[model samples]
Target: MLPAVPDRAVDELGRTEGGPETLGLLVRDQHTRRLLLLRAVLDAAESAGPGVCPAAALARLREDWALLEEAERLEPSAHRRGRPYRDGPVSGRPDGSVPVSEGPRGSVPVSEGPRGSVPVSEGGAVPGNRPPPSPVRALLLHPLTGPWARDTLRALRSGTGPLTGRDTREPARALAHFGSLAAVAAARAGVSYAVRLTAHDGVLTLPSLGALRTGGPGSGETEVAVVHRRGRLTLRRPGEADVVVRLQSGAGAWSEAAAWTSAYTLPGLVLDSAAVPLDDLDPYRTARGGPRPDTLSGPAVLDEADRKHWLHTWSGTAAALGLGGERRLAEAVTLLRCLVPLAAPPGSVPGGAGGSCSGTRREAFGAVLSSAPATATVFAATLVHEIQHTKLAALSEMMTLHHAGPEARHFAPWRPDPRPYDNLLQGAYSHLALADFFQRSALAATLPTLRDAAWAEHARYQAQVGAVLPALVGSGDLTVRGRKFVDRMVEVYERLAEQPPPRGHAARATAYVQAARALWTRRHAPGE
Candidate 1:
């Protein structure tokens, strides 16, 4: 409902610390054409089977890297370059779907045929120098190997993995160690999995697994078992990283979860070795920014006096807008708390920096509130507006869970009921944007500064999301319906500006939204 500012442009594209200004800017016009072509290979690898497409993609990437390296040698800093984060094997799963396990679905039995009578090397290598019967097995059993797990190993040595990076047995060695039982058990206990095993030196590259599960450190019970059809192996180490031995599944279809859920929600799912608890991240300590306070354990409770004061302030603004009523105020407050806490990651406390969710932690509402009417009105509008913005995040998570499988219950909010149009998540945002616009206009004279700041923030967020509307609507292009929705919101903002705040109940809020939307339709037809 807030008028969008025209100056803002949304940039969701990823950038590195010292990369080129843009991909296009990195190379000359003719060379830029070649870059786009090369990018296609990366995309294909990302989209297609990593086992199949990565080899080709990696070949192309390496070729390009060589050219760039050569160019830099001739003229240093000729093109923007950065220490690139290796396009590690894509999660071995397509984007948008829950990686139900560390590797692929399906189960493979442990090979019982023979341990190979060949003398196992003192370092687990065979002495005869005869190639092992199974190259994949050799890689898995070899100690000090790296991340070219069974899947990549098969692809390289046996034409079964993606062809992107080194195919030598070096990666195999890294895997043999981290993929061992000791590493797997440690990972399972929820420790950081992807530690720098070694720095990438020219001859030897250090490897890091995204996540691993191992046994209790120093405790015994160490062994490795391949699960999900040899697609993935469970590595258990008592106190180190837990390594998942995921193999190729030959399936290329990609899907995403409708919503994210707690780890417990899904049974037998593998946690990425890279993921650590949000609270555990960014520990409070004295540094360049000064001493940071430890985050509280949960949403802090407000004293009764503070609660009453807040209620009184919001109630007055609600009354002016004809949205006032004790029950409605209570409902709104209750909804605010439920929805606000939802913004925090599971187990997060106030002031914690990292979580599955991103964004700076906001101060508690009670801490910043006051008893003045203008203060109350501004607070009310902002609260309503924020509640609206949160819906999109909720919906995104819901969609993720829904896409994962039927078992994920986080998407219950989106189940199609008889009145299927009721999208609490979307509706909450839509209504709040409208309401905030109106409330801000009413208090313009008394709190001009707050009004402007709030409106600016609203507009910024709107612009941030505007382009994504078409994607959300699933039309791949903005449809008439979507345009009308935007138009109506704009109209309502104008209309609310013309009228005095109403003092009644549901009728006022309902009437205002209706008039605004109707005006929007009249001004712009669905297509127009």
Candidate 2:
């Protein structure tokens, strides 16, 4: 027989005497706001005097800001009528009952800050009591809510196919364990918890008598709710097609059950729990026990700090690019920031480029050509073009698990062609392609000054490529095939330039695709 449920619930039947539980969140929000302002100030200071300012001072400010923001953001919003409200827009809306973070008791941790903490909904009245008309099918859990709820929520949304995918299953299993603990706690507190498993068509709904809701795509919205009670655990739903849960203080009424439903359906209850090793559950693990391709690593696996850095760099670069609208610039910078780490490594750096690589490249290295006006535009386009080349190369490397070896130079195998010479030609063409593509699809999306920048670069690249390529290929020993390859590469790009701008990404992407394939096909031709 199980013990009585513990009465350590966040909510107590204290009647009207209890003051509001949400006042703490306001304090947390204040800290968060202050931190944001500090970050902005630090960014301005660093940008103002990149060389003059001490690196330590800048880093200190940034760290403090992040720490404070996390503490504030991670804290649970005071629950109002069972729903949790996070401090920022990033948090799901006010009526969202999704648990932000699991509490220490396997319940939702009431997050007060952005730190590694839990966030509770704003209101509370126990969610399972209000069941939606239709059978619950799915549940979305917020990361800020209960650990088990958040974990399970992550699992389902990730779709490694439920019991698979490390990101999905690991969280699910953690959630399960947390649910078990919560159940034990609830049992002690005289509250019942139960688990109900239902399957309709291919969809599997795991319901508990707790609050749960799915978040918007990528928003990490709260999706599931968890509750623990004495006797039987129950999982129910709030609406149709969405899964919810409810828990009551009773046991053993498994009658008239639907084939889709089996056993306990209460939050924090696991009737017959089984231990599944986290590694085995994740399908991303290979037969050899190695991680699969999509496994998180490096820049592909960006943390919050990386995300922030990306945003900062992108905003700075876009502004430098002379993008007029700050809002558009900010968004573009954010996207670009996401893409930067994924960008190709431009040749082996002599050593690691410091944290502010892109910034230093812009301000110190000075890629922008001021005199020729168009020179800056061409440089920007070329950089983007080369960046794409790197992206393509990286993708290929990941697919093959091998990097491409340098092709033997036709004239002198011992002395390879310089990167600059190659990059100059490649970048020129790429600039044309990217500039043209952006102009067509995202015209309004980009600031007008960008077009002027691109045009300037186009002219500069054309002049440089025409002058340099001839000298590089002039060596008498250069092979016909090699010469043809180079000539065709240049010629095709010239033709591509003359052709009208591509209609959309499909057309633009296709242009590169076809050209590359054509080049490859030409290489294997019989006449060679």
Runs in model 1 deviating more than 4 A are 1-383, 390-478, 500-528
lDDT digits (tens) for residues 59-135 of candidate 2? 43333223223223322231123322222212222442222222211122222432211222223111222221111
For model 2 the local lDDT of residue 143 reads: 13
lDDT of 2 at 62: 35
TM-score, model 2 to reference: 0.22
lDDT (0 to 1) per candidate: 0.28, 0.28
TM-scores for the candidates: 0.22, 0.22
Clashes of each: 83, 106
